[model samples]
Target chain A: MRKLRYRFSSDEALMLAYRDGDSGAFECLYHRHKDALFTFLYRGCGQPNVVEEVAQETWEAVINAASRYTPSAKFRTWLFQIGRRRMADHWRRVPQQESPLQEAAEPVAPATGPGDEDYTAFEQRVLRAVGELPADQRDALLLREQGFSLADISAITGAASETVKSRLRYGRTQLRAQLGDSL
Target chain B: MSRDTRREQGDALPLPEMNSPPQLDEKILAHARARAPQRRVTSRPGWMSGLAAASVVGIAVMITLPGQDGVHDTLPAPHWEARERTPAALSQPEALQADTLTDDVAQDARVDAQNGTQKDAQKGAQKTEGASLSAAPPKAVAAQSSARQSAGGLREEQARPDAQALERKMQAGASAKKIGRASPQPALNAVAPEAEQSAYRTPESSIERDQEDRDGATHQRMIEKGLETCAALLRSDDRPAAISCYAALRKDCGDCTLPPTLDAALEAQASDSVTSP
Candidate 1:
């Protein structure tokens, strides 16, 4: 009789399969979340060099801790926790750079009209407004954008659920004032 | 507005992407592949860990048990230490009673044979003295001799001795009366004049007879006192002594009354022994 084979579909399942010596499962998980994870770090720090370094370190930490990964929380939550930890460590090691609001004030390609150009400008203004907020608020807003629930964000950030809710509220209020009608 | 509503508004904003450097993905995947085949299983689920702990406890118990070695210079025999602890295997009181009964009967038979031999020697001496001193009335003598003959026949058959002794005493009393009437020797004259004419009836009107009657009553009281002592000891909770009391009653006082609770206690003990094993 032929032996039956199992397929890994979810993030946790794939990571566990990779820990059990299936290299293909790890590749599947890496492709699935790499773009979203990189975007989160990029928006989080706004320094491409630091973002790349932290993202690399986060993936490395995931690989190293794979054998100990329990499904107590979502795989996405686990992935982002390592990403946030690495970002925190990078900030601790390097001096703080100019904030994104200052960078947004600098000149760029001129706008054509209130068409696609105006919308792009509005999107840039929103990003800059989000990036200007305090680090806690910015992280809460970014995790919320990535479709994480308040409880999951709390777990990833190591803050209470109520605190995550307050940070998100503050972040939105600040971004609304910064962007005005663009919000 | 609610925090969740504001959160949804913030979530609608488009964020610019800065993808991970191509080289980093290659690096992590390479490491994951290399380590996957060599990963050591360090952590286990709760049930697996619990099973491992239970197995370890079982192994520890097996290692700590006594008598592991098979080859010894002297092997101990398998038997219970009665004084050290009661044997759980003795489930039947009937077996214990049967064994103790056999031991008691053997002991009594040996003692009875010895007493019979000694009594025969003493009887020969007493008969010679009686004949030389005085001749008893023939009728009374015949009656006493017949009673002794009957006792001897019963003794040979290993019948009960207490009943035989009572029969002999009664017959001897009858013979003493006839001798009192017929013989006028000084030995008979030493008795009171009214006593010489007495028919050896049970407790008649006489001070001397009454005294003799009181003495017999005292002897009977002593026998009753012994029976009560044996019965009281048997009724007690002291198990080893009570078992001995049972054997004594069966041997010496076969007709003694035993409380119903004795049989109940034996049955309870037998059940306890059976239940444990």
Candidate 2:
């Protein structure tokens, strides 16, 4: 009965419940967002090991801050914001190496019929193109894809709405140019 | 921007699915559960403090005021009854004694009035006989009798038509004797000067002796009254009242010894009660 109630609860409600000592509410909230948060981190920081570390740290930060949480923004926006910061912190500690996307990229696909084209290869190319984008653009693009408004992306990135818009536009234009015809 | 425009402008990248590890989930959930807020113990109700304060105040009042039950319990019953009986005894003695002695005095006064000249001769003979019976020195008795005769002659001269004055004088003498019986001071003071001048009897010593006698009389009266009450209860077959009355008498007059008849009666009643019950 309690689990049913927790499952149906909104993200903000779950966080509030966790704040008031309902560990099950936190479990529900963690499960709901863990995959998206892990993916965001995994894509942003292209190493699984670093992604795991950052994801763990981000969730730990959320757990530590449960008592102090306030529903000022969307739960996902706040979560991604913490993840971005953790990733940035990791980047600061260990300088960025050669882009992992550069090693994974393949030759541009020849113009052909949609049925004949390798869709999986095309999808991988698209992922690499997104990963290859500048960090700010990638964050703005990824946050926008995760269903945040331009304003929400700005809030998560601590950037102006105009800056977020510019980053998103720049990131999309670059992805289209890199994955031409197979788009 | 419109949804279509925004979607058209963004990349169609297929992001790979990812999730935190099972061990990591376990670790984080465990930490959260460990650090969860605990339910606080509820405080004592407001009425409890009020009740405590009321109890303290009640105890204080009980301690501060004199206990009416204790005063009644500790007071000796016999002495209390004696004190209650004293006023009636003091107030009624004259009336009580006057009833007994009035006829004798009236007869003597009438006889004396009828034999006027012979009364004088007879009074002289009677005075000599009273002086013979009195333990006072003869001279002292003669002097007192002479003083009384002179006072009686004056009284007779003032009211010669009736013997009422003589009767009044006799009643006054009887009342004086009653008062003397009630308290010894007046009777002691009435002693002849020769008797009062005895070596051992100073005024202070006489007063002390009178007090001791008064106390002894009062104690005796108390015991007699208590015994009478016990006897009445026993006669009425109120065994409990009788037992209680005897118990009180024993408590109040610890040195008093009960008469054999009353003691035996009480013993028989006690044994009967115990055996019957």
Candidate 3:
């Protein structure tokens, strides 16, 4: 759709306008959040098919619920919470599937030194290490990197503040161990 | 372990960049567009509604106010029983004769008061004239006879004239008699046919009047039953049900006279419904 003459001041405003029959406002909101939500889901679940399905379901939920949406919390927090719940539901249905980190981890081929090593291979290793962290720690770290407060992370994950802090601590320690010297 | 180190670790980690396929965006946008709520249409402006209401009232007044001079067309024709039961008679001439008799009797009483005796031959002459006037057209004569019988204690010395001569008396300014003496038949005769011409009647009005006359007693009974139901509902605090009863009553028995309490209840309910959220 072409750009709307009316600019929405915030995600909540856009959602409200969409609720009141302006489909174009929803288009703007969808564009703003689509990529970030996809990234969040993908990092949490390495399978492309699972990422695509969960992302689609999350956005569909947002669309269906636009009429009843209230601005009680930041739109990003709400969106991520939906995405996290979708991912959890998927895991419950498929409990025997390979862990996300194991699914994506490729064996590191031998190289003389870090300087000579492939940058893409190192990036893959880093992604694997991130995926390997316990789910709570990985979620806290992802939310923290996205500039959400610890309180916001706790809300999305349904964890207490202290528990989220401990998870982040353990997640970092384990990641540093796996990515030794290279970090 | 420290906040600074945690910050460094977050900064150093590669944040994944994942974009949904174009197909998913299309699907989501389609769903959103399909599910978008319909916009509310604006209400009619207040001035326009007010103007419409004024026009309706104006039209109603024009329809009802013109033919009021014709008594037979406006009010229901009095039943013979109602006419008979009325304390006063229904012919204007009879009232005039009665008034004339009252004056004569007053004059005689004053004379009698001044002097203790009256002339017998003069009294006999006045009684004969009174009997002569009592011989009027059949309907007027019957009414006068009935009136005289009812008012036997009233002066019997009054003479009554028939309908034809009485109509002349009516046309002659003795017409100033009170409405109590206005008979349905005489009033009908007095009105010009053009004056009797009323506003165009809608089919609904014709049907309403016909059905009303045919089923009037039944409708009154039904309205009484409905009022009982409405009262019961209201007592139970079921306002919506009570309002529904009032609505049905208004539609069905609109012309029937309601008790003031029921009318006030309906009006209060109407206003409350309009003003309540």
Candidate 4:
């Protein structure tokens, strides 16, 4: 985070002060970074529901950690990094869903019977496309599209820089082939 | 930090326009508070007795005072300000009503004067003084008459100041230099640009002051008028928009500004409810 010469105190100290019950510190913190943080979360999740959930979770983590977070690094870097991981985890749990695929195949319960076979076929095709990519590559590619940096991915997955780089490179190449004309 | 990954400044980040989940805020805060460790200490029976004694004396003293000028007013009685400016609110309404209150005050003054003369008459040693004592009530009536006569000289005193203050604040807004309306325009203009902006940032502050002083259907309408103006501003100008929004929220909804997530949550819940039903 960029530090401006605001009257009273430093940002980290103010945050720590807020943890000790100084509401003014929270005011300063929110005013200073809510806009950029929200923007990051919005792009990082792509899904409005997911973005909002991740943002809230990230800020909650910040508030809870304020008493414990060290001044070793910029507060926002740590903050956004939490958002990045939450978004990636969120995607993994729900799976990346596209609107066209949903419309192309109506949702059918297996309990509903064989009348939905056509819908199942469309669903299979979409799933097959995603399944073609290796797991590491698929995650890396998704993270990139979600606006996570190679460094952010590294932090999120706890992967080495070299590993994350290779995964993204291989992932993009494979995704291009799978996506074909769509790419 | 990746090489060749840099894009346009605009593309690097998303601009935040929308709000996040409200439940998440409550959840996080509630969780944090629940997790927060409580400080522990022991209480003694001996100390309890002394503490109770001090509390009793303190409470007794507080109950005895008028509270108009007491230490208990440090934070002010729920809305002392609303009560403080109430006397001035006597000026509102049709002159008939205002005149009624004035007449009430005059009647009290006449009573006081009559009582004084009655005491003087009872103590008088001479018939002349007793006669004069009989004359006291008439003198008070005369005084009341003269006070009514002086109204022509006091019209400016009674009306123009509050109206002018309201106009300066409503029109000048961020330019309102004095937190006060009647503060001369030059003095208001003398307010530094930043200070002036801050002054009108919460126009409702002054309006709140006015409304709190006089809480009747008429004042309520005036508050709603201020709110309508604020909501209109929310639709039109961007200056002071947040304050206007806060004001409208306080006026209409108090502290609950539902997060943008509320609409999504409501939509999600409705879908789920239909499926379950």
Candidate 5:
């Protein structure tokens, strides 16, 4: 009954409940956002291992900060903001040997099944194009793809709204140029 | 279409499918569960608070009640001193009361000696004679019997202070006799009839033969007031306060007899205090 009740609760309500010592609320919240957050990190960093590490650290930071949490902003925006900062700190501590775009540019594997061939190939192409864009443009485009408003993207990335708009425009233009006729 | 909307529409493309591993979910959830905040304990148990309140009230009653000096003051100095030296004397309250009456008579003799008033000297001589003949001996014997019946059973230790008080009374009588010798003829005439009449009197009336009956009447009024206070406390259903008031009464007036109902109430309250947690 409690799980069913929490399932329909808003993200902020669930987070407040977790802050007030209901672990079930946190479980409901984690399951709701785990896939989206993992995809965001994986697309940002282009490495499965780094995605898992940064995601775990981000959730750990959330758990440690539950006692002090106030509902000043949406829980989703706060979560993605922490994920973004952890990803940035990881890159700062261990600088990439080469650009993430260069690393993603080498990733074309043929689909195993005929039924998923066309869509899988297209999905990989789009992900690769998104990964190859400059880091700021890619982050803006990805966060925009995750359905954040322009203001939310600006807040998460700590950039001006115009800067975020410019990044999204340039990123889409680059993806269009790279995957020209297919897009 | 607007430029930003066109860009947003153009960027809507298929994304890769991904999810975090089950093992990592288990690990983070375990950490969250482990770090969950515990509810605070905000109140104590009912009995605990009751016990604390009772202890505070008991301490306040002990601090506010009167001391034992009022009853002990009427006793002669030498007798009080000797009783203070003997630890067992404290347990013999009846003997102390008997000693108080005897010492008051002695004090009257001393006052008569200093004043050299023939009337006071005659009264003093009569009281001194009454104490030796009719008042002091019977009360001292009754006090010894009561002391033997008391819980401590210290009759012999109680008798020692009475003997000291009696010797002091003899000294006061000798001084009064010296004053009487100054006007031997008139003093004899004044005391002769009263001495014969005092012999047939009861011990209670004899003990009431103070030269200044006003002092005895005032002491009786104080004892009555104290007992009334004790009775009022019991009527108000404040057992602890009633017990405290009764204890003060006993300390102030050791010989003052309590009515039967108040005595029974005090016993019941004392038993309840002993039996309760």
Candidate 6:
């Protein structure tokens, strides 16, 4: 509820500490990327509920796995990678119905929470357009928008770096088309 | 038109972004903060810097930190700790003999403590003896017999740190000898009844051994060993050795009752063997 009191170094640093039983570091990490991750999931999967479930599950996996994670992998890369695996698992558990984005775009509900109406509005469109994309293209575009390097994106997607670049090239081109006059 | 105009024009479109809901970040971050894992400062030293490096450097750093430092209590490597921590194997007549000898030595030290004359000498002896004798034999024994219960070898192997090597081994010995693979018995009942009660049954603690945990260890070990052997065989092109080795492991464990997931794991192992270079 209150702002967490932690001087975190980086997301990776925070994850390392959190993995070793540092709750505050985890809180700092959550705050740092909560929106980015939620936006990533919300847009990537197109179900606000699934976004919430997967995001929560992702955090749980990170917590449960603090000790087991390898430091050789980038923290974000690992987190998203785990998130994607969980997403796949979730789908496997339940059948793949249409994502909410295709059926209907979820309106950003007013809450006693963070974010200005302006940014939420901008992100929501980015979110829906993203949902309408093919899984690979959607993930590439979303990762790029969230400031992932192509190499990092490639690692997360388990594709070659060049493949990631092509995904981005194709993804951005699609976004440019889909965003239409907005581009 | 550039991204700016495109974004601006897209702003007015029938897209989801056009509707500005209040406080979405607040809602999401609120959940993130509520559910995020706890984070401690990096007293464990330069960890988590591996995101950008290649695999080798990352593995090196991780290995450098191997288990937790003594202060932290997390293990560095499962193999060493696991072997040291199990006690069921100690009942093998050989290991128990070691335990009995240690028990006598412990009694002698207790007697020396009452006399209060050789306290310093006794403490030093106790420390080394404790390291070599107090904790490990029963562990090696228990780990072998208890393998049937814990499912994920990784979980059991990793979870070994939760139990003191001595107590778990003794407990495993007492239980395994009594139950013979029905349900898992606690692994640390070496000390007197009062001490055992105090150690494992503290208030707010439900530390009963998980039924699933035992099965997990064998799975974990099998998978790890299989993967390691597979990788090695691939590099060496030792086809006959690899297949035979895999078959032997499978046959040995075949009649033994296993967790349901094991069938899938074994199948995966066979598939990997087929596909491996």
Whole-model Cα lDDT of every candidate shown, in order: 0.57, 0.62, 0.62, 0.46, 0.64, 0.53
What does candidate 6's lDDT look like per residue over A1-183, in tens digits? 323345537677777766666566766776666666666675566676677778777867776676665578778878888887788788888887776566443446532222456445444555667677778877777676566777888888888988888877776677667655443
| Candidate with more favorable, higher DockQ: 1 or 4 | 1
Candidate 6 positional error at A119, Å: 9.4
Which of 1 and 5 is ahead in lDDT? 5
Report the Cα lDDT for candidate 2.
0.62
Candidate 2 lDDT over A1-183, as tens digits, reads 999999889999999988887888998998999888887887776567788889889988898888888998888889999999999898888867777555443535643413335554554555677778988999887777667888889889999999999898898788778766555
Candidate 6 falls in which docking quality class? incorrect
Pairs of residues clashing in candidate 5? none
Please, what are the lDDT tens digits per residue for candidate 2 over residues B1-277? Answer: 5434654664445555467788877877887788766534479889999999999999999788733332123223432232223323533332222211222222234445465335445545655544443545546545654464345434433333334433334335433232122211111222222211211112222233346556776766776677679989988999789878878876787665553355663565455431110
Top-scoring candidate (lDDT) = 5
Q: How many collisions per candidate?
A: 0, 0, 4, 0, 0, 52
Weakest ten-residue segment in model 6 chain B by summed lDDT: B199-208
TM values, all candidates: 0.44, 0.46, 0.47, 0.30, 0.47, 0.37
What are the per-residue Cα lDDT tens digits for candidate 3 across A41-120?
87777778888898888988888888788999988899999999988888888774556656775737532223445655
Best DockQ among the predictions, by candidate number? 5
What lDDT tens digits, residue by residue, belong to model 6 across residues B1-277?
4334544554222223221123554454454455455544546444444544567787888789734433113212421233244445445434444343333333333333244345346546645653554355666645533442233233333323332332344346533332222222233333332222222221101112222334555665665576567456645888677666656655656643322343344555566532210
lDDT of each residue in A123-179, candidate 1, tens digit only:
555667777899899999999888789999999988999999999998888877765
Give the lDDT of residue B205 in candidate 3. Answer: 27
Model 6 chain A worst lDDT run, 10 consecutive residues = A105-114
Question: Candidate 2 chain B, which ten residues in sequence have the lowest lDDT sum?
Answer: B195-204
Q: Write the per-residue lDDT of candidate 4 for residues B10-108, one digit (tens) a residue.
A: 221111234545565456555555544332345676988999999999999978965344212332232223223333353322222323233322322
lDDT of 1 by residue, B206-275 (tens): 2233455566555445434544554567667665676565455445543433333444434544454311
Error of 2 at B231 (Å): 77
The reply for model 6, stretches above 4 Å from the true place, is A1-5, A106-126, B1-277
**How does model 3 fare in lDDT?**
0.62
iRMSD per model? 4.8, 3.6, 4.4, 9.3, 4.2, 7.0
Compared with the true structure, what per-residue lDDT tens digits does model 3 show for residues B1-277? 4435664665546444678789888988998899887755678888998999999999999788754443334334332222223335445455435533433333333222233235234445656666665565656655665555556433222212122222333334422233223333322221222211211111112224335445755765676577678978988999788878877876776675553455575565455421110
